[model samples]
Target: MANPTNFPDLQVPGGRMHDDQELCEHLLRSLDRPALLEILPSKIDLGGTGLFAKEVIPEGTEVFRSIPLLNCIGHEMSEFMCDYCHTSLTNGIDAAGHLRIAGDALPTISRCTQCGVCSYCSKDCQRKAWRKYHKLECPVLGQHPHASAEARALYRLIAMVKQDSLSEQEWRALAYLKAHEEQWSGHLEDLMYYQPQVDNPHRSTPLAFAVAARSAVRGAETLMQPGIDNLQLYGLYFRILTNDMDVAGPLHPNIGRTVDLVGSLMNHSCDPNTFAFFEGRQLRVRSLKPIQAGEEITVSYVDAREGFMMRHDVLWFKYFIDCKCNRCEEEELRISTLMSQESSSFEDFYQAEKELIDIRNEVSRDYKAFRSEDGINQVKTAISTVVSQIFRTQPWPDTLLPMCHMKQILAELSFKLNTNPNQIAIYTLQSCFGITQRSGPHWVYALHSLATHLTPMTAALNRLKNTPPLLLLLALIMRLLAPPAPPATPPDCPATPRQFWDFYNGLLYELVLQSRKTYGTDSACAVALVEKYARARARSSWLGPEERPLPGERGFAERFGEAQVAMLG
Candidate 1:
């Protein structure tokens, strides 16, 4: 069957898929919705499919957005996050609507009466999900309480596919997905050689194929249903490992994973021009830097902070690609200072793991008693000490799991009603890794945190040339994180005068012009700094003209006045 949209299958000049001059026009036309940019499914010089830009796409502009073909929240997080939309249920609420207690059950939570297995924030979410796929999967969810995240995802997809239920493009997309089941058999054979029970046909493979045999069979039933056997479950699991992306939103925690056929068209690169994030269920991709009309659009799939050797190993293992991106070629990464020295003895690794778990549990208990801002430092100190205790054997990078928890706590502590922004910024900076400079989901989050803590009137603006990294960070904060709508700006917050606001605005515009040379005109970093709020009526300025990065640059005196501004217009 051909694509319903008649999106030409990837090919090159002379009807071949190599020696590509330009092949994105056809795929760009195949997009189902209006897009500021188009996708070109063409072959790379490296002998694989690649997505290219069909036009000049500017940075900060929305590239495209795609809804998930199939997605679900992990079973462990089902109670704490919405199963349908993936909204976090972490905000504390009471009958009076003030956050009087910590981690109390949300008022919106509505427990399902029939299955008693899932929770929802509203009946609308419950009804919509039931109509979509939950009716079939609900019957079996109870039987697989300990199922792997991959197993749950497969179950949802298998259950959703019905006769005449999906569109032609949807079916074609599903059919074309890569399933590394052949790779699975090789691993199984090696495991079976040492442990024969692993190959038992009657036994369901734990984690890999955690669903009950009868349950999966019933879910995938239909005369018109595409054939999927028990072993094929492994194929689904493998495809998910390579293709799925976590769904995240502005205010909610990441609650689910999604995949799309066109989304997979883009090839991997460490230094990519494009970056992606979630707007609810839709995956939105945007340019991180400007691209010429014929340029190829790329996005990073792995954590870009790790060493090149570590990155090479992970990419080869999961995505089956060896990155030859510029950063890889330069080999200029800041190696980890995060050392956790330890012996490799089995007993030592085991004991350290136990101590780490105990510490985490203790921290969780103490975290409950103290509300936001109360004893935040105490929690941070205790957590950091525990992280140290667990580090006698494992390298710090290997202990990323615990370190992740520490960073999260520090972030939470930073939001205390009257926490010191400078103090918070210092602590947060110490926890950063090498790749935290430009982008990463967590790094961006930190940037937003730092932005909120900054009082624009502070003396930092005068020293913009001192820390380019911090300047880039502040710009990101202003662009991505808006002033909390409706100004719950704390009572203890400093009165931000007009001249101070003008200084920040003018400084941002100055950064924008500088970024055109360093990053790109379309770079999101520069665009954020000078986009709007920085321009106001001119007034007398401090800091001489010599302080300007550019000779002809405008000053706070030239653009903005001593008038308080609510936001950039």
Candidate 2:
């Protein structure tokens, strides 16, 4: 365990330094974020902390950009990514479920020769990683090559502490996070005695914790300044699980998990004002909506697009938090109102609620058991079952949340199968609708982008079934996907078999405009969108008609109205 007596500057958690607003400022200063944000006691979480905006923060303003304090790539993805810089080794798999060949222009990833366990994109990154913490870790990882990503992350954190690689401020920030040791220990005991199957795979049992901790200690203990016991290690593990964020990027959505000082301090909300996005391994949080001065800066820990019940249950089970956010309160009232209006009797409502929950469980079980090698028919059957069981229930509107949850799984399965673009579009569209109806269009734009890909000018445009709805959806998606400002100079257009320059111009142009609003005109997202717009413009200049949408597709309002009618059916 860390000894505060050795370092007089470091105060224990729950001490005056942690509770005092003045001393906390010094800790927040270490983050070097915008002065517009401050750490404050949260009204939302009783006796918990939160981040607040010190000044009015406009939409699209960059709140902060953080390089991870600690991060690790998942074991399954270690082969594909550089363990040092977290860069992709290959172009990754294409839409057809085949691995895409990396072009000669890209840098090649190389494995470390000593241990052959970690990979690096360049020699510089390799040396830097070794100097940072990998000098001690490589041997351990080499011996236990099959260690889980979480265990590896914890091991790396411990190695950093032993080597004094982290600054005093960084160490203090991490130690300040709550471990929930008592609550988690009780939960583990309950799981051991009562449950045969683990509800969450990431959760640790007493036996598993002992084995992981012993293995880590055996390899790294020799190097420690102040050694830690199993109890202290278990406490750290609980803290890691509670505060970690999924490290996702544009290229790879599920790369790994990371924990950082500033990012973890932000609390969860069902309807958050800010959203985090990534550029390589660096995380940048931007305001989704304008935030007023003194307002709490919150982000959704779970996907806000998810139905209320799913969000509520996950929060309660994992964080031990019963969310009483405004959104949850409204949703609760809405559900009650809906039940009273739609239900013929209390008994009917109970039966419908029971049926909905049962269907969710059944889908969840089968979905987990499903493997890529399995037939697509099983997934299709699950989708059908969810729809038939819940979509026509007595209070079907109340069941939309679970219905959407099931559709989310179906959309993911469709993407994995990579067999039918049409199915992908349909499932993605349904999934997006479920989100847009509740959270708003911004949350569902990524899903909509998947569907929009099917309607590219080069695709078989005439073969599309719901042309108006599809076209409208594509237009809306492109509009949302675009950044604010376009490039000053158009990029050269690449040759295609058949060029629909007009469609390309409209789609890419919308993407550029939307990007400017969502991300700043100078942001990486906006810059990338501008480059794409340039190519479309270069092509449209000579090869096609004036910038126009597909034939007979109306403006957004009309299209949205038509789409709503079509979607409800």
Winning model by lDDT: 2
Cα displacement (Å) at residue 372, model 1: 11
| Candidate 2 residue-wise lDDT at 101 | 38
Candidate that scores best on TM-score: 2
Candidate 2 local distance difference test against the native: 0.58
Model 1 spans with C-alpha error above 4 angstroms:
1-47, 75-77, 86-107, 114-118, 194-227, 251-253, 303-314, 328-333, 336-408, 411-425, 429-444, 451-554, 557-569
In model 2, what lDDT does residue 109 have?
Answer: 70
Supply candidate 2's per-residue lDDT for 520.
56
lDDT tens per residue, model 1, 1-569: 23221222211124322223333443344454333444444444254456666677766555666666776665545677667764445522222323223355554655567555567777888988887777766766656554545556666665565312345455444444554456555654555354544334322233223223224444434321435444554555566656775554432335556666566666678777776655445566766778777787787766554445545655765566678777776652322222313423334433443455455445545654543565676666665565465455443452243344455456555645346654454444444332234443444444444434454324454444232223223332232233333334332333233334444445444444443333334433334433322322222134323233321355434434222222221
Q: Please report how far candidate 2 places residue 19 from its true position, in Å.
A: 3.6
TM-score of 1: 0.59
Please state the error at residue 43 of candidate 2 in Å: 2.3
Per-model TM-score, in order, reads 0.59, 0.72
Candidate 1 weakest lDDT stretch, 10 residues: 4-13
lDDT of 1: 0.49
